[model samples]
Target: MFYRIPSLGGLSPFVSLLSLALLAHNIDAASSGVINYGGDVPIGSKLVQVHVIYRHGDRNPKSPYPKSHYHDLKSWPGGWGELTDTGILQQIKLGILLKALYGPQNYGLLPEEFNVKIYKSVTTDVDRTIMSLIANQAGLWRSLKGKGIHEPDVQWNPTPFRVIADNKYDTIFGQNCSKAEKLVDMFRDERFEQLKNENLQLFQYAQENSGYEIMTHPTQICWLYDTLTVELLRKGIIPEWANALYPEPLESFLMEYLKAGSLTEEMRRLTGGPLLKTIITAMKNLTMGKDTIKMYAYSAHETSIYDVLAALCSPPKKPPGYTATLLFELFQYQNSFFLRILYRPGPDQTAFPMKIPGCGEQYICSLKKFEEITQHVLPKDLVAECTV
Candidate 1:
């Protein structure tokens, strides 16, 4: 007998294992969860557009410890902060699945299987994100070239795409938040400008390691940097930046800042100012693009996801995964255009209860345009186990 426990952040190894086993068991099309293309989905409805976001897949997390804590990559099996062999396989499998779902025949393309307007992107942080995209692209490129369908393809195409985010999402947010808060606190301590000398190392670290260029724009300096300083002043955490009321607890402050849900009002006050402007522009672009575009894809991070969602005025919740793409598919009915949202965890894999607003049905597969077919094919047993 199998038992279930509350999954850690909705993903548990036991659940993953059980779901895979159940999925394998119900691969036959006749099964309940099996997707029989002709029967379930209406034949005439075709997919016209698509958008996706996903995590970079499994990789070693950056910084397993606080500044005061000491540990090294050698402590782990594969050395510090690197993708495992299994992570490589995960990307490869994702590519193969993408090819199967959006093959030449499905997309009605000419050059090959992946001969569509596909824009690929990655972060320059480490080899993991780049390699994962490379492996995934390999499957698509090979499938399009008709090279090694049954076996692996060694050939590669020379194509470059947009890949951003050199700094990990958490790292960027954490550093910026900490610095902002610390700066504000220093101002209130009456130490004014003295705290800058005290935490010189932190400022240097932020410059060297934070992966963002220090802005010289006076507004940004105050908006992004000094606003944080101002918040610190309000908190009375620091003594006016020149003199220290107490020793700057940089290590302790940074440690607490990096953890999930650690972003507080102070951090939000600083970060939110810039994001509000960005969100407005993004929303405007989407609205204008909606007139002609059917699907939109944003190759962004969890912070981006949170930004967009919060822009839409969503409640505070975690955005999962690196490649987690948010899809906004506009459904055109007789006289109205309704927006349908899809959240993809990976290639052709989605969470349960996918419903397109106008479709009137859940788990609809025929409308493959902007849909992850993997979910419709997942058996009930698999779904049950997956939810564990």
Candidate 2:
């Protein structure tokens, strides 16, 4: 069910799951203005606006578990939780990809010059995220040399990114929400306990290898797995103690742990509400011809991307990879407007259009339908609900 498109340089763009039959023959046909991915686009559709939410790229482990034996923990160049040079490069590549997709001569969705009125970027006020945004912007506009205004050697343009205040409920990551905390406390219940008990052997194996007593809590275990996984990738060597640990079951448990908050309708509404509301409002503003901004970018965490995916009724197939992106695109066809959801699994992958369950096939739906189907999960009042 996946389709592959050859890149301009003859490299194969990553495979996408959108049906090949839905693609257009003329990718750059100006009349329709459809931004085709390997010739895939809804017939007669013209690209209008795009909103992207993405996780920061590769980074040093955020923290080590108590009594941890992670060897590289003390040697990471940026220390713990900060972006590494590799992380910057990952995001830079992503920015280059974005330029190819949306820059003026390509999709014509964004202007060549840096215009504050046409683009807005937002990021969680974290060092990694802010640095990622900077690196991404460098690649996004790498080709544009500002109208001979700056020094002749300058190849970069400033793309303003607003950093959301820390400790605010506006972003769920790294924030303290009492209600969300209370709801998440359900992991301590008997049901989750049974789930943990079923995986006791795996937990013990992880503990033995990690040099730490593995906590039975879902998030705690998930954190351990995530930290270790990244470390393994970075080090390119698996320790002898980890030989007995099976990766699949541990990953499943970690996914379950991460998704625990969105397992129920009420929890989904509470955890993902504010972000959903922001996206909906932006969509509304675009459709009404009131918003001039062509692209809105958010640099955030994996949890933020996952929660938004769950809110859209499209839980991610796996944890979002480094620089994983979720794009909400608004397309205009004559007098009608349609919305398409696309996901890029990583900086190296092609973006696949995603199906919004119950909305429609082809992964494209009427704007009204998009709103209707998503309304139930959108929080009516985030502050009031977050405290409940």
Candidate 3:
């Protein structure tokens, strides 16, 4: 966690001093330390650039399910409906926080300024996601108004943020399977059938058990065939060897197989489940698009976040909000673009490394250094923070 001198006055001096000492010791472990984000910004201005992936504010379920497995949206104290009164209040307060932090002039935004050019795209899910997008933006709109920016020309266009329900979702293992799948297909010719036959045992069970989902077992299959086989050849799981092989197909899933233990651990580490690349693609599109976009917001489930990180082959550290919102600032610097991550603690409103159920607010993880497109993959030393 990035340790900070207390900005509030509630703590006693002695407590503060002790906290400071402990923070100094732990800061290096959690994060190297906040980068002085001065030089890296556009034109070297320390102006803030924000990208937020927020959950919809408090709201009722879209509809009552006759036999639902998830939590009841109606049971949320508010009627079976849109954002509750409290939710609107929550979003409005967030607006206040935004103006306070980013400052109105930073983005040339305004309070009473609801008309800012904010480009927004949301997943085409049910009401919660769509409502959350509307409500969260409303919060910012209200907040922007306080800063003199009135109701902005908010656009809620549908994007490919949602999973494309097809054979691919039910199939495909590891990340970058689009590339991996191509690699696998190269061996389909008759000349490689002999080699394919050698590996047929690996897929034999799936073919026999037609009901079995090979895609569901992508990591396991990759683990047994790829990582494990490679480790067996080396006779040990050394870090250097692991790193070299991780770029190969199915390696990401293989690593997970080696780490699995408790279900809780699975949930904790499985922040980005499957659809990682889609999120990255959407983010990239937003930045490159011509919308004069001030803020780009994503309202998705926890799995969406996890999958995006995985797809990016990003360091595996996940965001911290319950319905965490991760803000990424896409800045064009001297013909290059740099991304900065701002994590918001959520549904509860906190920042990273602070402990909240299903949230890790203790530290902020950024690829600010690795976020450069040229250095998409991380160096060895930074491996611990991410799965990639």
Candidate 2 positional error at 216, Å: 5.6
The TM-score that candidate 1 achieves is: 0.43
Q: Which scores greater on lDDT, model 1 or model 2?
A: 2
For all predicted structures, in order, the TM-scores are 0.43, 0.83, 0.41
Off by over 4 Å in 2: 1-41, 65-73, 146-154, 168-175, 188-192, 215-218
Best by lDDT: 2
Clash count for each candidate, listed in order shown: 39, 1, 39
**Cα lDDT of model 2 by residue, 157-242, tens digit:** 55678888865356434245567667766743544466658877767767666655564453456667677677687887556655
Please provide, for model 3 over 1-388, each residue's C-alpha lDDT reduced to its tens digit, 9 standing for 90 to 100: 2233344256543232222221222122112322223222345533223555555555544343222222354344544545554344344344334433443533433333444354444443445555455444443443221343232222221222333232323221122334323333332222234433555554445223322234343332432333233233223342342343344433433333322211232222222332222233444555467345455455655445444444233323423223455555555545454455555555444443222111122122232333343133222221132232
Alpha-carbon local distance difference test for all models: 0.36, 0.68, 0.37
lDDT, candidate 1, 1-388, per-residue tens: 0112223344443223222211221122123221223223233434444444444555553433222112345533454445544454455444444444344444321124333343433344456566656655554445223443332212344345445543213221222344444644543232323434555654444434322232221111111232223223223432244122112343233222222122443333233223333222333344456323222223334454454333333322333443454544333334333334445443334422245432454433222332232222112222122221
- From the highest lDDT down, the ranking of the candidates is 2, 3, 1
Winner by TM-score between candidate 3 and candidate 1: 1
> What is the overall TM-score of model 2 with all chains considered together?
0.83
Best by TM-score: 2
